[model samples]
Structure formats: structure tokens, C-alpha cells
Target: MPVVREFTLPDLGEGLTGAEIIRWLVEVGEVVAVDQPVVEVETAKASVEVPCPYGGVVTARFGAVGEEVPVGAPLVTVAVAASEGDDDAGGSGNVLVGYGTAGHSAAPRRRRVRPVQTRPAAVPAPQPTAQPAPRPARSGPLPVISPLVRRTARELGVDLATVSGSGPDGLILRADVTRAAAAVVSRETSAAAPEPAVAWDDDVVPLRGLRRTVAEKLSRSRREIPDATCWVDADATGLLALKDQLAARAAAPRIGLLPLLARICTAALARHPDLNASVVTEPDGTPTGIRRHRAVHLGFAAQTERGLMVPVVRDAQLLTTEQLAAEMARLTEAARTGSLTPAELTGGTFTLNNYGVFGVDGSTPIINHPEAAMLGVGRIAAKPWVHDGELAVRQVTQLSFTFDHRVCDGGTAGGFLRFVADCVENPGELLRYL
Candidate 1:
């Protein structure tokens, strides 16, 4: 008798209820060792590869790629135990390495109630000589475009079918809709005729994946947490010069402003520990006060192929600027290629979002969950300002900080921002503190 065991999907941590299957590395009839990677799953924040927990011959796979599987659902099964003295009877032919134990009893399998398939009544076969009728001409309302475009067209009172499309395969775009509206205006003016204004048709967009997660998180953050935003303009001339000098130096490691920003934030947290804390409420409807953290795990908001992901640099306060830069680069590359592990995406004590790369001036970024504050860096631009009692051109950047008012006081937040600004303005000062 052979005993089989089924391995179910384990919680990848962070209380995630489910994940989308990205790929399956194992197949049926293949022997696998414990801790061997078997499947890749994509959560809202990141994609993670999961290792098998049992050693045995793979008997079945429960989920397909791109399908979402709930936590504790059976993912794969293996035959681990066999009758004694059955080695010559095709029992346990090969033992998997790294798996010390065997012959574990399998859990009771859950039977899914699949819908019964019924044979459909056979239809009379069509004659071979019968010709198919041509499709009816698209009339009346001009075969309305997509619901989104149709709503825009109706709101502008422009006929979509008459509008020329510049999109691929002659599909209408938002720009085409705007142009059609303008053309209608011009034609009505020339003909001295009045056109009736049309109202927009109701439209809907399905929320899924990152967009859906973003919506839910943001809504909860806004409704539950009281947020306050503070803005400051900083002189980045010194920072730019330092970056260029470092890039040109042979001994200095190549780096960007992001790593420098992370270092500054880590240092600032030491002074204003309140901003480094989170507000947690008790289950009995009582609000427990601020909780400050000791470790500085800085989360860097990275834009990836699937969506936005934040991978943390653990204990950034202890790392040298060079080490921080190298780690940031490695983690960023891993995020872009979907190779980041689950551990890398968790335990962030603070977050830094670089909107400067996108040429944005400033934005109030939402704090990553459980972190009280987040900082946004804007584009550095040359502008005229009064310096040393004289008008001079200097590189200036905008800083936006959003914090949970429940945890961080306005004064503490202001001081923290000023500290970061000081670090950016005086690069040499960082070395002294370090």
C-alpha cells in the first residue's frame, strides 16, 4: 500500500488571502524534493516563487497558471509511503534528497462538486451548398465604440461611427473623440445650425489586480487615518554636484540621489522617532498611542512591469552610503525582473518614493502601511533665487511629506523634513554624521 500526501499553498506572510499563479515549475509523474521550487505566485505587491514542502512523485496539480488560488488550497500531491519489502515491486524507486522524512499519512482530500456535462441535442447538418448570409450593415447609432469612448462621444454629442480613428485597426481613441467634437463644432458654426447637447451614457470599469488593490488601500488609508501633508522647497545644487563628482570618481561607487535620500531619512528618524512610529488601535475600540520602531527598514518604491512594488533595505541606518547604493541597485533590478523574494518586500519601517525621475514637481505620497510617514522627491530644476543677497541661478527641488497625524506631530514632521533638506544641501555633512 502506498500512502500519498498533498501539499497545500502556505501563507506567504502578511496575511495575504490569495495569489495569482504565474507559473508551475513541476509536472505530474515527476519526483520532487522538499523545499524545491514548484510554482510562482503574483500578489498585489510582488511576485514570489514558492517551494514544495513534501518529497514524492507529483500526482496532480490543482490550479492553472494565471488562476487565483486561495490560501490552504491543495496545490500538488506526492506518494511518500509504500508497503514494506516492496522495493522490487515498483515502490519508492528513488529517494528525494534534502527530504529526511517519508511515509507521512495524507490528509483527507476535499471533493469538488463539478457540474455534470450533458450531451446537447444534435442539430440537423447544414447542406454543403447553402451559402451563409452576409452580416447586416451596422446601422443606427453607428455601432457605438467602447463604453468609455461611447460615454465621451455622447457627452460631446459627436457620432462615433462618423469619427475617423487613428488607432491601430482603425479603432477610435480619446484623441479621436476630442477631434470629432471639435469638427462637429466647426461644421455647425459654418452651417449656422444649432446642435442639441447630448448627455453621457453611464459607463463602468472593472477593478482588478494592482488598480483594485490601490483603490482599496487608499480608501482605507484616507477614511481611517487622519493624514497631514507638509511641503518644502530645497536647494539641490550641492546634491547634484556631489552626484556628478561621485559618478566621475574611480574609488567612489556609482550612485544616484535615491540612496542618498534613504540615508538622510534613516538619520532623520533617529532625531524624530515619532515619525518613525505607527498608530495601532486595540480590538476593544480603544486607540493605543504611537509605537516607535528601533530598526530602520527603508522601503524604496520601485516601478515594475506588473505594477508598483516596494522592496525594503533592511537596517539602512547601519549601512554605509556605498553599501546602501549597491543594495538599492540590486533590489531594484530584482524587482524589475520579478525575481524578488517575499522577505524583501516586507518589514519596511519607512518609505521613499522618487517622483523626480518622472519629472514631477511634488506629490503627497501615501504612507506604506504600518509606517507613519512617507517622503516624495520631486524633479531638480534650475531656477532663479536670491542667494547671498544677490539673484543667482541654482538647482532647486520640491519635497512633499505625508504623515499620519495620529502618530506624528506637525512640529516633529517639520523638523524631520528640515533634517533631510540639510543633508541634501550639505553632502559633506553626511560623512561627519556617519
Candidate 2:
């Protein structure tokens, strides 16, 4: 008899306890190789392709697409052929997602797996696609992860104890609870009840995945941080001239406006270090003061097809204009393709948001949580301004700075914003820091 081994979902990223199933790479009764990607999942941090450690016949798969599965929940079961001398048959030596160990190896070969109807005790059985039956009387703590899921169940008034879990070890997933809630509505409706005269046409979108994560983060920021915004109109003619000058140079790296502003930000942060720090809070949300980071892990906003993501450039204060341009370009491409790792998306002392791309003049952006401040750059356009006592059409832009009031008062914030504005007006100001 072939031995059936279960493979559970592993932690995909730092602090990510669960992930939503985006796609399935393997099907039931399919032959799989050890360390082969079995499924694709999206967490709050990033999207990841998780590989299975066991190589054998895939006997069963749990969780449907769009379903959220918690870490350590069973994902799939593989049945490997029993062989002489090997205590664990069809096992893998490599552990990709925190499961499996060395010594066992199985080649990609066909194995006669019993009927799919017979699954291991850990594998979840399929449920009715349309209205699932009410969850039977079960006894145990609800195997649930991700507070978002629990909140969804609670908001929908679905009794989790009565809902059947389609995840390994009967772990309840978001999709399962949603289905159970729908089943309750179906059971309560009367077949003879008259239908609506005209069907409602409103499209309802449930906040999930990245959108939900962003909502929660922004809400937390509003609740925790007593934030304030300061704005300054800057004369950007010098900055644009410098950009032109650099472009005119022989074999100079193509630098964008963002990198130049980023360079200025680093210099400005050096002068006002308080803006480059995060407030430390006790677990119960008690303020313990602020943590000043020596190295500037600069985060910049990158809008992608999925959503808005802030990709951090670590130790950005050490990089020059050319280097910052290169790093920003790489991270922007990764963000567009949804290939950024969790590390690339987090740990920032400050953020730079260029809303100018959208042709916006100004915006009061909510500070990226945990970070003390964010500098918003508006569109640079030709505006009439007094230059050297003469009114001339000069390239001008609005700079909006949002900072945590808890970290610094208006004086420090004004000083930082003024430093950035001066750098924009006189690119020579940055030479002092360089």
C-alpha cells in the first residue's frame, strides 16, 4: 500500500499568518515533483508561489480559488510508493515552506493512487458548490487565522461552529464561512416569496487581499497617529535645470525627478533626523516615545495594477543620485509585475509619494503607518513667480509634508519642509550634504 503524506501551507512572508489562494498549479490525481510549486497565494505583503516538498501522486487538494487558508493548514496530500529500506516512502529531502526534512527523495514517477474518493484524515473533502448544508454539530475551538476572516464572519452573522471547513484538519476558511452564510439565506427564503420587480444593479465589491490590508493600515494610522500636514510652494526651476544638465552630460545615467527629490529628501532628513523615525508603542497602544533610525530605509509609493504599494530602498541615505535612480527603477518594475518580496515592501523610516503623475496639484496624504513622515510632490509646471526680484514664468511645484505630531512639533516639521523647498530652489544646497 502506498503511504499518504500531507503537506500543509507554510508561512509565506514575515508576519503573514494566512494567504488567499490565487490559483492552483496541480490538480487531484496529478503527478508532482518534489519542491515543485503547487499553488499561488496572495497575502497582505506580496503574492507568492508555494511549492510542495513531497513528490508523489497528488491525492487531494483543499481550498478553492479566492479562499483564504491559514498557515499550517493542510494543502494537499501525496501518496508515494512504498519501497524497501526507506522508512518514509516518496518523501522529499528539501523543505521549501517549513515542512519536510532531508534524507528522503522520490523521483518523478507514476504511482497507482487509490480512488480520489478515499482521502487522508487531514485532507478536506469537497462540499456542494451551490448551497452547502448547515455545518453539523462539531466540538472544538474554531481553527481560524487572520482577523479579517473572523471579522467577515462576524459581520455576516455566520455561526462558525455550524459551518463546515474545507481546509485541512477541518480548518475553516473565509470561503467556507461565506458559503455557510449564503446557505443560511437560501434556507430562510421562501420558495413562494415574490421576486423583486426589478433586480438591483449595484455592484458590490468586498474588500479583500491587498485592498483590505490597505484599509486596515490606513484606519490604524488615523486612529493611532495624531498627524498634521504642512505645505510649501517651491521654485523647481533649479531642479529641472539640474536634471537637464545631468542629462546633457556624456554617459550620464538617466535620472528621473523622483530620484532627485529622493536625494534631496535624504539630505533634508540628515538635518532633521526626527522626521526619519517611528514612534514606539506598547502592546496595549501606550506611547513609549520614538525610535530614531540611523540608516534611512526610504519608501516610495508605486502604483501597480494590483494596487498602491510602497517599495523601500534600504540605506537610501548612502546611495547617490545615479544609484537611487537604478534602485527605484528596479523596485518600480517589481511592483508593476507584482514580484516584490515582503522585505522590499516594508521597513521604512520615511516615504516619498509623487502624486504629480496623476496631474494633481496637492493632496493631504495619510502618513504611511509606522513611518513618521511622508513628503508629497505635486506636478511641476510653469508658474509666474518672482525670481531675483523679477516676475518670471518658472517651474514650480507644491510640496506637502505629513508627519506624526507625536514625533515632532510644528517647528521641526517646518524646518524639514523648508530644507526640502530650499533644495528644490537651489540644487547647490544639496552639495553641502554630498
Q: How well does candidate 2 match the true structure in TM-score terms? A: 0.82
**Alpha-carbon runs more than 4 Å astray in model 2:** 83-154, 159-196, 248-252
For 1-434, candidate 1 gives per-residue lDDT tens digits of 44456566665455566677778888766777766777887766566767765666676565656556666666776665554213333223222232112232243333322222332222112223222332232334333234445667788887766776543234455556766777667666656643564433334443544556667777766666778899898889999898888888888778888888888888888878778777787765256877788888899889977678788999898898889999999999998998776678878888999988899999977777767899999999999977779999999999988999888678888988888888888877777666
Q: Candidate 1's C-alpha lDDT? A: 0.70
In model 1, which runs have C-alpha deviations exceeding 4 angstroms?
1-5, 26-36, 53-59, 78-214, 284-286
Please state the error at residue 209 of candidate 1 in Å. Answer: 6.1
| Clashing residue pairs, backbone N/CA/C < 3 A, model 1 | none
Please, what are the lDDT tens digits per residue for candidate 2 over residues 259-338? 99999999999999988899999987778989999999999999999989999999999998999999999999998988
- Candidate 2: residue pairs that collide: 135-162
TM-score for each candidate, following the candidate numbering: 0.68, 0.82
